[model samples]
Target chain A: MEPIIIEGTPKTPTIKFDSSKGEFEIKGRSIPENSVEFYKPLVDWLDLYKESPLNKTVVNIRLEYFNTSSSKCILDVFKKLEAIHKAKNDVEVNWYYEEDDEDMLEAGEDYESIIRVPFKMIEIVE
Target chain B: MSFNVESYFSDISSGNPIHFYKGNIDSDLINKVLDTVEGKLIKGNEHSKLRKKVYNVLVESLQNLYHHVDKVPDDFEDQTSDKFGILEVIKEENGYRIITGNFVQADNVEKLEEKIKRINRSSHEEITELYKFILNHQRISSKGGGGLGLVDIARKTGNRLEYQFKKYNEESSFFYLNIFVSENY
Candidate 1:
């Protein structure tokens, strides 16, 4: 499948899904007015990828901030990844937060508790 | 309705306001608001935790204004009634305060008031449970939210949601919501 590469805007995050490289990343702020619509294609892509899986999939999520609506849409993204992980694929989520950002760290923990995948909390020194 | 530039400036100037605007809410506007707030927060001397928390709260608060702003009444005596709103970020000695105000239909104010009152009264534990429960059971509203922004703001602060509704004639009311992020937290 073709990869999804969306440039980041101030109100939306950049999404890069390289099927060939087995790496997916969502970086920057995600507070889109229409979050459900904004994330629909990315969610749809993961659904199609379920059929042909990579040996190891690393998903990097580094968001400076996201609104409540974006939070739900983000959960939808994680749910898709959970399915892949449950199918026995090597799926790992690298949840990055800036150093001393306790709120972001706890947000990652919230997803980790709900999803079965191993979440690595990576702290960026900024 | 005509905007009071004088009073708006006075309210913001009462404190060390970093950003203040009252106008349309769109992608560009949201981006500009967050950009200015984030840059200001990073340049300040607050702890990383407080800075990030305040930024997150500001994001949600501003988005609320964007999605939930009621259309200015047809008889609002203005031609530029495009879901306008107001936002102000003021600096305090101990923390930062975010003040956001928007127009809401008079009929919607009762329910909104009740929701905020419930959030203000909930303990931290109850709030966490309420937030989780809403995440699991609540359907996303047509407005692209699950009605969690205010609750999430309360949870992030671990305090009451300061809010008020001022009567704007009979058809609409101006809703004011405020959140404070303290350094000690």
Candidate 2:
């Protein structure tokens, strides 16, 4: 599958999904006016990747902030990864947060508690 | 009390007022506003993390107005502008405060009051629990929000939400929501 590289906008995030390398990452703000519309392609891309996912899939989520709608869409993204992880594939989600951003840290924890995939939290220093 | 436009603006713009818009709002206009606010924050040299919180709160607050804005009662002059709302983002000495006001049916106020009051009454730990519970078992509304915006705002700022309402007529009222985020938090 061809890689998906979407540059970040002020209201959206940057999604760099390299299916060949089984590397997926999302960064920056994600508060799109219509999150479902913005996230549809990525969701479909993950659905395609399930058939021939790389030996180990690593997802790096380094978002500064996302609104309520984006939060649900993000959880949907995780569910996709979980589907692959359940099929005996090696999957790891690297959740990064700023050192002082307790909210981001806890947001990661919330997702961790809900999703079954292994989450590696990385704290970025101020 | 009659709704005085000047007093409403003055009350919400207590701090160093940065931007205020009052009129019909939609997704297109909201994206434009978000862009302008992001530029202002970036130019102000706010720390990256702090900037994110302010921007996030602004997104939720403004979007709330966009999705659920009700007619300001047909009797209030022109009907075209009845779908209007007010937004004021001010920079405080310590951080920033976001104030948004929009008209809604008088009947909805009761449910909103109960919801916000419940949120305001919780401690940090309790809020965390409620946030998780809601997020995990989310029944997303038509607005695409799972009712997590208010909880997220409280969690991010560690501050209670301040709000008030003024009746516009027999059918509608203006709802004002105040949220402040401290840099320390």
Candidate 3:
């Protein structure tokens, strides 16, 4: 699949999903004006990815902040991953947070506890 | 009933330290407010980190107002009545202060207070875990009543939640929440 790239703003994050490298990275802030509209394509792509199936899928999330609607969309993305995992494909989510950012790290753990996929919480020095 | 519209505008637009918006809540107004805040924030040379925090807080607070504020039909007989809340941002000595106020039924205040307290008490790790748990297990409430918004705000601020409540009338009270994100902190 063609890579998905979105520019990040103070209010939004940059999303880079490279299908060829099997790497999906979401970075920056995510407070879009319309969460549903902004996230529609990413969700759609994930749905398609599930059908074709990859040997291994890695999702990297390094979001500094996201609004509630964006939070919901993130959940939707994780749910899709869970579905893919249920189908017996290798999938992992690497959640990155600033070293002092306890909230982001806790958020990663929260997502990890709920989904069956392996979630790695990494602290990066900013 | 007579309405003191002039006084209302004066109270909001006067040379008060805080810039306040008071009136009907809608998406258009929310965006407008964000634009105004963005202009001021960037002027202070806040760069990307401060700007992102301010933007996220603005969105969450406005969403709270839009979803929780009591509303009556536009054509209601009491045209003077206002249904929405107020949002204010002030420049403080150390950093920016964001404040939101709205009227809520008395019954709902306790739940909200409890949620804020829980967020304040939670460790960074706990907050992260809580966010994920809510994502997987909590169903989004109809009419946007869920606590996910508050969770997002708390996570973004990375500071203790500050709030107060004042009785507005017999059946309801005005809830005020103030969050401070210091430039140096």
Candidate 4:
């Protein structure tokens, strides 16, 4: 599969999904007014990735701030990963937050509770 | 008391006003407002956590206005505008206050009020649970969010969502939302 790489913007996150390395990462702010439009391609790409199995997939999410709309889209992305996880593939999610950002930490926890994939909460020091 | 847009905007725009906008709201304006506010937050040397919190809530608040703001009343001064609204960012001693105002059809007032009241009544943990539940169950509408913007704002600020509905006319009313983000929080 051709890797999907989208550069970050002031309002959107950087997306890097390389199937060759089984590596996926989303970093930066995601406060787009139309989050569905911004995230639709990623969700589509994930659906395609699910077809060709990667033995192990590691996903990292490091968002500074995402609006509520983006939050829902993020969940959609995770739900797709959850499908792959349940299909007997190894999937791990690394959720990163700033040390003082308790809201972000709790956000990660919220996702951890909802999704079936294992999540590791990593704190970045200010 | 009846709500008057002119008085409300004048009252809130005073007292160390940072940014105040009264006009139509669209995607492009949202991006500009966020960029302008982010620049001011950085220039002020606000703490990272506080800055992020304020920015986050502002994003939700503005987007809420974008998604939900009603058309200006036909007789209203800004009749030419669509999705007309007012936004003010003020500098307070302990924190920043973000105030947004927009007209809503009188018919929709009760529903919107009940939603905010329900959110205000929820404890932090309960709100978190509610957010997760909605995230999982609710489908995203064409308007974009799954009714999660206000809930997310309350969850982030840990404060009651202050709001008022002023009677604009028999057909519609103006809604004002005040959100405060404290430096110490």
Query: B6-66 in candidate 2: lDDT tens per residue?
Result: 3666654357988888888887888888889989999999997789889888888888887
Tens-place lDDT per residue, model 1, B1-185, is 66342253364444588888877787688778888888888888677778877888888887787778888766654448476888888988888989888879999999999899888888887887787777756767987766889988898887688777777778888788878888887
Ordering by DockQ: 4, 2, 1, 3
Question: Model 4, range B1-185, lDDT digits (tens) per residue?
Answer: 33458576566544587899989898899989989999999999988888999899899999998888877877787777788989999888888999999999999999999999999999998998899898888988876656999999888888899999988789898899998888877
Please write out the lDDT profile of model 4 over residues A1-126, one tens digit for every residue: 899999999989999999898899999999888899999999999999998768899999999998888888999999999999999999999999999989999999999999999999999985
Which window of ten consecutive residues has the lowest lDDT sum in model 1 chain B? B3-12
What's the TM-score of every candidate structure?
0.89, 0.91, 0.72, 0.96
lDDT of 2 by residue, A1-126 (tens): 899999998779999999888899999989875788899899999999998898899999999878888888899899999999999999999999989777788889999999999999999986
Model 4 regions more than 4 Å off: B1-4, B9-15
Docking class of 1: medium
RMSD of each: 2.7, 2.2, 5.0, 1.8
Which candidate number maximizes DockQ? 4
Q: Model 4 - which docking category?
A: high
Any idea what lDDT model 3 has? 0.74
Better of 2 and 3 by lDDT: 2
Question: Where does candidate 3 chain A have its weakest 10-residue lDDT segment?
Answer: A100-109
lDDT of 3 by residue, B1-185 (tens): 23222233333342234468877777678768888888878887875566667677778888888777754334333345355677888776666677787777878888889988999999866876676677667755666534577777777777787887766555666677778766654
Give the deviation of candidate 1 from the true structure as CA RMSD.
2.7
DockQ computed for model 1 against the true two-chain complex using alpha carbons: 0.62
Better of 1 and 4 by TM-score: 4
The local distance difference test score of each candidate is: 0.83, 0.86, 0.74, 0.89
Select the stronger candidate by lDDT from 3 and 4: 4
